[model samples]
Structures are given as C-alpha cells and as structure tokens.
Target: MAPSSNTRPILLIVDGDPEVLRALAFMAETRGYGVIGCATAAGALADLDGSVSCLVLDQNLPDVPGVRLLKQIRDAGIRTPALLMATSPSAALQIQAAAAAAPIVEKPLLDESLFQQIENLLAGA
Candidate 1:
C-alpha cells in the first residue's frame, strides 16, 4: 500500500529477524513513512542515503552490530538519525550508542514509544 503522508519520510530498518523487519516496516508504512527493510548490515549500508529520514537498526546483525553499522554510516558522512534496537543492551553497547547519538529502542516493541521516537527524530530532522 502507498504511504498515507504526502511527505512520507523514508525509514531504513535493518534487522536480522524477518518477522521483526516485516512488522516494523508495516508499522512505519501505516504511519505514513516510506519503509525500506533489510536483513543485513551490508544491504543497509548500500541503501544508506541522504533521503532516509531515520534508521531503525537491530543490535544483533549477521555481519555487524547495529551500533557499528551506525558508526560506518557516520564515517561515510551521513548524519541521519538512527534508533538502535536491542534487548537489555550492555554497558559498552549503551556507551557506544550514546557516543553515536543513536538511542536504543528495546526489542519486542510493545507500545507506541517506537513511533513516538521516530516522529521526534523526524521532527528534529
């Protein structure tokens, strides 16, 4: 289905779980965001661009950690805001995410917080 919003901010979500990826993409699309879901960090890196309004990356990826991927994205000069999805993140991971300015969204996204975070990020973008 087409996005509901005219602007339709693009969101790139990289997750290792197919189910999680599909669910997140559908949720974002329903909220009027254009969603590009990928199963690997490499695909996410390749798809990274200025057009993307935000990113939702899973912490446990096949090729690399979500935080590491964010670093690569920044190193490549893309300042797009990102949300790192993790379950009970470690102190080091949390520190790294803070360093990269990517907030950690807990997994099993059970409430509207994820959408709120996305909107907040987009608003500041």
Candidate 2:
C-alpha cells in the first residue's frame, strides 16, 4: 500500500551537484516523499539507515562512486532499495549495478521517470 501523508517515504538522495540535488529533492517532495539530500558519499553513508525508504544515488559521487557506496551500505546491513543515477553509464558500471540490483535512472531525468521508478521500487519493496 502507498504510504499515507503521515507516513511518507523518506528518500536519501546523494548527488555531487548542489543544483541537481535541490531540484531532485524538490521534485520528490512534490511527489509526497521526504528527502534527505547529501552532496557526498560520506554524508549519505552517515545518514543511511532503516528509516530511509529508498536511495537516489548519483553514479559519479566525489568521495566514492554510488555503486561502491551501495556496497558499503549493504555491507552495513541496510537493505534499502537504491536507484542509481547517471548521465551515461559505462557497460561495466551497468553490470555492477545490475549485480547489486540497482536500476540506473539516467540524468536529464524527464517525464517524471524518477518518481515513477521510486513508486515501482516502493511497491516492490
């Protein structure tokens, strides 16, 4: 079931670009999700926990790549579903993310794709 207003899903969004982070957070908020925006892998890691319903991670994070960050999170035992964001991901990155079961949401996010993906992930989760 979709979460009620009082139980809105919390999203952990980690992106290097401040503008993109703000824009993504604004978009998710408009869609009824709470957003915790972070500019680096460390910040994201610090905030990650069971309370975060989902993760929107930029593939090119400055401190650590998004996929590696996901690995660390998994190693820490947080099973939150993650959506990997990339402008143009290489094949190797694609394979790695697939192995980790993270779907890549390409940049220039258009047509509410990010929200759609979030809904799908939430539904499956």
Candidate 3:
C-alpha cells in the first residue's frame, strides 16, 4: 500500500551514479520515505513537486554543480530542505553550501550519520 501523503517524508534524490541512486532509493523506501531518484539536475528540477519534504543532492553533478542547483531552486522560492553530499568537499564548497542554507554531508555515507542528520533537518523543518 502507498504510504499516506502526510505520514511519509517525500525525498528527492539527485545523483549521477545509478548505483548510488538505487541504493538511496532502497534505503529511503525501506525507511518509509517516498523516494524520487533523478540522475541529473534538470530531471531533479522537473520532479520537485509539492509533496517533496527533502532534497538529497550530489555535490558534483555532470550537468551542474549541486550548490548551483540548490541556489536556483531557492531563487525560485522553493524552500525544500536540502542535504548536499560530496567526497571530501572543498572548504569553499562547504562555505558556499552553508551560505545557501544547505547542509553538506561528506560522501562515503559510512555510518548512520546521514540518516540521523536527515531526520534532524526534516524534523526541524
């Protein structure tokens, strides 16, 4: 059965890697969040619907920088909470993401930190 709209956290995940996308989707679904996986910035932008409660983005997409995408969405007045992930993110990138009000989750998502952080962000939102 489909989860009730108000009960599930709708997550929009944007990553270039198909493997990562699949893993995230499975994780999100297993955790009972409605998952929307997109392989590109354009695809993600197109799918940003009202139901989405969070934006999970890869820092370096082939088509556009994850920060850039977040900025664009914010500029468009979309206030969806965003979690940006990168592998060893540069200092400048970290500052930029914070300036944009998006939290940066360093890549290799080894522990439960990612999920914990997501929970905090969404709960606060």
**Candidate maximizing lDDT:** 2
Residue-wise lDDT of candidate 3 within 8-88, one digit each (tens)? 988999999999999989987888788899999999999998989889999879899999999899999998888899999
Q: Per-residue alpha-carbon lDDT of model 1 for 1-125, expressed as tens digits? A: 33457677999999999998999999887878888889999999888877888999999999999999999998988889888999999999999999988888887799987888787777784
TM-score of each: 0.93, 0.93, 0.93
List ranges where model 2 is wrong by over 4 Å: 1-3
For 16-120, candidate 2 gives per-residue lDDT tens digits of 999999999998887788999999999998888778999999989999999999888878887888889988999999998887878898888877678878888
* lDDT (CA) per prediction: 0.88, 0.89, 0.88
Collision pairs in model 2: none
Q: What clash count goes with each model?
A: 0, 0, 0
TM-score of 3: 0.93
Supply the global lDDT for candidate 1.
Answer: 0.88
Q: lDDT value for candidate 3?
A: 0.88
Model 3 poorest 10 in a row by lDDT: 1-10
Q: Which residue segments of model 3 deviate by more than 4 Å?
A: 1-6
